[model samples]
Target: MGGVAQSFGPFSVRRLMDGVFEAPVADLRHLGGSGPLAAFTAGVAGSTLPMDVNCFLLRSAEGLTLVDAGCGSAWGARYGHARAAMKEAGIDPGDIDRVLITHLHGDHALGLIESESAYFPRAEIVIPARDFAFFTDEAQRAAVPAARRGGFDVAARVRRAYGDRIRLVGEGAVTEGIVLLPLPGHTPGQAGYRLGSGENALVIIGDALHLAEAQAADPDLGFIYDVDPVIAGDTRRRLLGEAAEQGWALAGGHLPGILRARATEGRFVLTAV
Candidate 1:
């Protein structure tokens, strides 16, 4: 897959394309059956929607940090690109100093392990405490209502691979100039990382808004994967609004192309960065 790169102050932000998958249009029920949604789908005129699976690498003189790993081969054949994409960008997994995970969803966290080992062997893994508790606690795993227990099972595999190297973080600067902004509701601990010092900053919002075309058109519309649709909608609106207001570059795990966001006429718009 081809890679996309951008500079954020002294840090280099690079996009690693994992792969793409087709999602049914009905999956976007949050958009409702009328208004702009009808028009939006009519524009595409397709039964299946194309969604990109992406991960980003943040590099600086002091350290190398990765924001979410792509879906591993375990999820499906369409994913599993972290190692290859890094190699394409001339980066070795061992050279990464830290991995800032937004959440523990399979597509975002399964790449933590490769071939039954820690993919980035030397990097410190950072994750949200809420997610760590929800996905790793045996009691919580057992109570996860069956349908969602698969995530806990996969997370257990990751825990076994990374072991003591994992670090749980809250709302604050995780390292250097990168700060963790908790954007929950997609998952209890889903978050985004804020990087760069000034005007040239960017936020890698993992799964905050999967389809930029639809969500950017209407943030109130929620995806089926959201753990709490109401809260997820609020988080999406707030974060995207903040980004637009501050003129910050925005990126997402499932945005179709090189992602960036802006606001105009009371609506969020995305462009390739």
Candidate 2:
């Protein structure tokens, strides 16, 4: 929560741990049950998985930019500590000039609003074009399960607050040294931001792969929250492959801290950066 979590070129990335939660192993399902269940569960501690709810702050010559927002005042006592986290880091909400959202999920986008208004009033919100179109489409709500409609509600709230300040982007440069890479499947527009290139590269993938060890071992394992488990699995594997080959330092919405990917025969080994 203090100092640099990882550095990429001139950018210093720091993690802001909002809260923690326990995910039952039962919630993790494999694609068509094709992956090795025994090995996947064996990598996990027990039936319950304790994961960190994290967001990152990216500092560079371009100004203050946040990778993603944590759960705001909506998710209850276990979350919604953004203000406190920012205070601890000696930063004010207004100081953040831009916010690059990885997706439109509740935990990823709900922090945009605080006290029924824009929390980062001065910041321009950057979101994936696909996600903006999907969540904003009211007709898509009927197709999505009622339980998964929370992200839709979040999209509405964010739009109502930020209005024209939101910018829809594709897979390209969102700012100086930051490149948006489309890695959909969990959500239609879910993506990661690549900072720099090659071994020193740091990729911020939010909710792309939740259980670091298990998912890295077998990306075929998808979480219950995934909108399209099959596509999510494919995306996970693709991202893992890219990360490993490039020797990327990875960060995520649910990861505890920064990790580097090492490719073995068929799996990736995550080492703390």
Candidate 3:
């Protein structure tokens, strides 16, 4: 969990560091090969990419809202420390009324359960409709590689625990100010939340670009975790263009910190905001 906090409109947001893991470079692929892109991927192949699993905690008059839950006890003791981080910050888990899931991946959804039950006793698990549909479909499990098939199990476990408490939605206003932005391809229904507007605006894009700098420079690169890599790249390109044009900042589950898109030469790069 992070001690730093930023304000967006009437909401105070905190990026809670849930866990950190090394993402293998081999998992990345170039949707379309470019000389520079191919070389970049090859250069990083033998190494691991360090990524942070972060969850955002938003506070407003509407109570507390959490964006994505860490992998609670899901991957064993190596992760799932976000709960303690929250407690350390004097946050009561029961106060969180909404746990907005970006996708059904373990780090994002499995935290909804603790001791084989809902972690937040009172929070409504708001999940993207498309993700809920696709991940839950046993038929769709075959769509992804066996290594990436874990989302199906994660989705089922979360669904079973949350049960009637789960709320499925497409792209729309989640509350008074927060809006869900449709960012598919990473998963069939990866959701990003837009907060505030303009220069001060912040968008919590979940795994849209696992490697912000690498992907920002070349939006065609995607992780093997992506169900539809092509669409994922498209979404990344669109979002980067939008952010650069709109002067908005982006935050993500794997992204280190808040970053803004800046067009350098003919390519775009992410600069810390």
* Residue 5 local lDDT, model 3: 84
TM-score list, all predictions: 0.90, 0.94, 0.95
lDDT of each: 0.80, 0.85, 0.87
Ranking by TM-score: 3, 2, 1
Question: Candidate 1, TM-score vs. the true structure?
Answer: 0.90
Best by TM-score: 3
Candidate 3: C-alpha RMSD after superposition: 1.6
lDDT string for model 1 (148-204, tens) is: 676687678878999999999999888888888889888888888888744587888
Best by lDDT: 3
Count of clashes in candidate 1: 0
Q: What is candidate 3's lDDT per residue for 1-273, written digit by digit as tens?
A: 674889887789888888888887766678666665568866674578889998899888888999999898878877888888889888877978899999989888788988788889989999999999998887888766788898888888888888899999889888877889999989989999988889878899998889888889889887788888899989999999898998989999899988889888988999987
Model 3 weakest lDDT span, ten residues long: 36-45
Q: How many backbone overlaps does candidate 3 show?
A: 0
Local distance difference test, candidate 3: 0.87
Q: Tens digits of per-residue lDDT for model 2 on 1-273?
A: 443656787788888877776888888788757357655777677788988888888888999998889887778888876558788778988899999999999788888888669999799999999988899998999899998898898899999999999999999998889999998989999989999888878899989979888788878887788988889999988888878888888899887688888889868778788
